[model samples]
Target: ADMPGISKDRLNVKVEGDTLTIEGDAEIPMPEGMEPLYADVRATHYQRSFTLSSEMDTEKVEASLKHGVLTLHIPKREEHKPRKIEVQVD
Candidate 1:
């Protein structure tokens, strides 16, 4: 399903260890000629949680949003990522 009203920019996310938290607000527009309907459709705050894999490095996690588009870049830990090492033997 496509959530046209809900885009990436309208949200904020934070990740910790194997868990990720998503928080954001959504705006709802009122229809025309709906004066009789008494309702409060303001942007409501929301939160969600998710479990991540062990390969993720919570310390290097980064996120940014522009023009209603959100982007998150999670870099791996130095020790966990591939690196060249020298072999020392006696």
Candidate 2:
């Protein structure tokens, strides 16, 4: 789940030593006229971490943000990808 007003600039994604971290912050604007009686929101900061193995190609990663949504693409290495293996029988 993600907040409505989060942008790409506020997000930080990085991968290091088999660890992937995704973090960001959201700003909440104070409503005009009337103040909130109680405010308890996770909109201030967000963080997520993932453990990656050797199969993940960390060097070649892609990320895109559209309409306040973040998308990340992590592709597998050529050796890790699915391929055909031939067997010889004599």
RMSD values for the candidates in order, in angstroms, are 5.9, 2.8
Q: Tens-digit lDDT track for model 2 on 1-90? A: 354456777888899989988888886678688787787674578888999879989999788877767788999988999998899999
Clashing pairs in 1: none
Q: Taking the tens digit of each residue's C-alpha lDDT, what string does model 1 give over 2-83?
A: 1224556667687766998877776666578665355444446666777877878887778766654556787877777898
TM-score of model 2 vs. true structure: 0.76
Query: Which candidate leads the pack in lDDT?
Result: 2
**TM-score (all chains, Cα) for each model:** 0.56, 0.76
Give per-residue lDDT, candidate 1, residue 58: 85
